[model samples]
Target: MLPRARPTRVVRMPDTSRLDGMTSTVTTPSSESVPRSHPADRTGAQVAADAAAVIGSADLSEAGLRRFLHGLPGVDRVGADGRAAHLGTRSIKTTAKAWALDLTISMVDLTTLEGADTPGKVRSLVAKARTPEPGDPTCPRPAAVCVYGDMVAEARDAVGNSGIRVAAVATAFPSGRAGRQVRLADTRDAVAAGADEIDMVIDRGAFLSGGFRKVYDDIVAVREVCHDAEHPAHLKVILETGELATYDNVRRASWLAMLAGADFIKTSTGKVSPAATLPVTVIMLEAVRDFLATTGVQVGVKPAGGIRTAKDAIKYLVSVNEVAGEPWLDPDYFRFGASSLLNDVLLQRQKLATGAYSGPDYVTID
Candidate 1:
């Protein structure tokens, strides 16, 4: 049977009681306190410059990571998880269902990151992203195609002028254990090969050991390199929140990425266990929303891995609208990282329109 869409409600901020046992004070800069980016014609250098100004004369030493993290307002575990569960219960129906399905398709990153990935595979993925459904020209294309750095050129070449962006996962992806120099070089190669966005993993070891300075510096260095690239790719910092092990860590990592000038903060590498859960995404969304409120600079968010259904995607949109507001509903600010998700969304769209379930033969398998 087809899954029925349920009614969705506007999620209001939880009560203050939810704040109990959470961090009460945050030392992060407010909108008036932080230096604002140039509103017009901004570039990569401007991002780095604004970040430097934001980090001026602060205690980012090893000992200060905890203090800095604790200084931020704490997250209420129950409140966040409750919000996610509640939002997931929403059933989008009829025209709302159709709208959400299309919006979800638009927000997808259409990822394919496997050790065995090849040029032919990437080209096919690009074709799937562009046409989606061969007979349905009404179907919109996905936002971008995500692949490993090595396959970037192949993907880019195939996606040429289709209005589709090509994103590359770099910096020794999934496990970011490479040295800073190697990671920067990795980013440069991808950009030179025409990657519009670069997804880099952070050294989870550093973050777990309170080496926050190391983590922050690495993101800054990569951001600088991305800006300096001739094509100027946007940087997406993957925190691998499942490894972080707590909402507090997720919130801290989100802020750390934003403070380091990450164009987007991602949930996971999709190569790890427990990739992209609702609670983790919720905390990240809150971080971006709060960052925008405080710095007047908006950074995007991508929740990669484990989100497979059209229902799951729309629930994320509902969260984005409710937690981050309507501004983040656009493809520029939000994206999904998945390979099979496109087919599932296509299947769901067909089911909604025809009053019947779609078999695998009906959609493209990339």
Candidate 2:
């Protein structure tokens, strides 16, 4: 009887070390909204008492929790441009189904993404990404292009006619440390410019500070604001696993975000170092799997940043295929947040079909 869903607290970097072995606690009665406790404020004794209270009253069954999560509000904005759109048009459904893509965070490490890698540059990169190659068995394009909020419009425009949906990062990306007004405005602006989906960062500092309510409120507000926009942006809450070190903490954040209203739960902004490792993606996808099974809702997963080569993308794909099975293999439920990975994947694909080391551009994929 507990209230359906609750928002999760943000996890800050400075406090991540503290949660290395210990995770925050949520306490709630069976028929009431879950009350989240910030361990940072309460004395050790008080914190332990709250933890015991939560453990005592709440129904911790994953099945029931997942069902409730699946029932949350939000439009399922699956684009027609994914494998569904591409191969369907060609009248060869199997070719489109033959390939799946990673929903990347799309930031390059060699350059300063904010300045040198301006919105225009990002847009250009996106353009190259949407162009299909001659060797493509079905001539199908990638599912989506993910970028910073400022470039969402540019990306949409650049990928025009290619049928790729543009995804924008919001909520003060890389650090969810902005004022509520600022965060809402960012979401509004991104959606206004035609972003189909949003990748938002959670305030890790607040979560670490035991500011669960503050963090939850902020994410919920963004979720609401994102939903209000014309484009009906999909919200992807980034847990910033590098900032949240423990597997338990990652699991907790995954559930909390799912409960809060995340259509997708992604890792890292691709701006932070050590972004998107397999272990973390595994943990998050596991949460996605459980959340889906229990709730009957399908949520997407994006492992952003640090995935540069085809091999890395393949490894991630292999892992997802192994752990989550074929249902989760579609671009709808799986994605990789990479900027430089497409070319390699295409190059490898071409080589596999025709044994020749083609020029970087010969692959016809950017």
Candidate 3:
């Protein structure tokens, strides 16, 4: 006679909204709720790992993930914008201004994604990234050089050993309308080309159509492709906030990306009508702050596009300092995805060093 196997017991998580002042909610399984056999299902560990493979065992079902995002506290658009506007008014003067300018420069992901971007352009961009100001060795280089997937190898070769990384925008970048297989192939190509980081755009059509599962799965697929033993590419999920159209949607998208194993949640692709506004960036900062508080997992934030001047970049730094705290100030935790913004910061740095303001020709063209 054969012994019958015992059936495993599963229970639905209790409703968390009814709880008074619950800082953390469990719409999905809590750490203890997941089976011990599935180490990846452990909420605390998986959240901290922030790896795409871990997300496969995440306790949340498709419906649960949707509920969690929808149940998140709503954003007050006016209040958020007001706070950002007020933060913008804070002045950085003298030595403080000089320090802010340097910090801003260090955070820049100097980007060039044009179809016209050639090896020469990427090499020039790489030279600029390595030495923003050839005359002043004191001036630090920007964090990374961002390019299209096909240009990753060229960018990597040009910026070799300079400590400035090479980031490739993949997965049918800026549009994200390509099929899943094609998107995955695009990401793999970048990684195989030695891209240090991968910035992928989410399918906004799926998101807007309430295809949260599809979006999450897509991110997971890309994240998996980014992982390597010697050189794992950091994944930055771009939500394209302009197309999202609401602060609440931004917040939801931010959470969705974090849950799907995104190392960073980017604000925009910079191709759209409206890109990287203060209010939208504020919402993302809040999402990272709150997400960190609850999951003990910190994800970086990158506000791409529409940031053209040193003043605007400083304002963003200010918001980061006040909202996300000093820990997020590092390049590992924050980034500014800008092309022309780097020139402005460099010019300002020159102005601080010398008494005279530098012209456009003073800085590197790329």
Q: CA lDDT of 47 in candidate 2?
A: 24
The candidate 1 region of ten consecutive residues with least summed lDDT is 4-13
Tell me the tens digit of each residue's lDDT in model 2 across 292-366.
443334566778778877656656666565445556566667777665676666665566556776567574332
* Candidates sorted by lDDT, best first: 3, 1, 2
Comparing 1 with 2 on TM-score, the higher-scoring candidate is 1
Question: On residues 78-116, what C-alpha lDDT tens digit does candidate 3 reach at each position?
Answer: 777787888799988889999999998899999998989
- Model 2 scores worst on lDDT over the 10 consecutive residues at 22-31
> What lDDT score goes with residue 317 in model 1?
88
Candidate 3 lowest-lDDT run of ten: 18-27
Clashes of 1: 3
Candidate 1 lDDT over residue span 1-366, tens digit each: 333222121222223232222222322334464443421224544544443334332334555455656566677788778878887888889899899999999989999998899899999999899899788899999999999999998998899999999999999887988889898899999999999999999999998888887998998888887777778888899999889988888988987888777889999999888999887887887777666654567788999999998888988988887677677788988999988888999999999889998988998766
Ranking by TM-score: 1, 3, 2
Clashes of 3: 0
Clashing residue pairs in candidate 3 are none
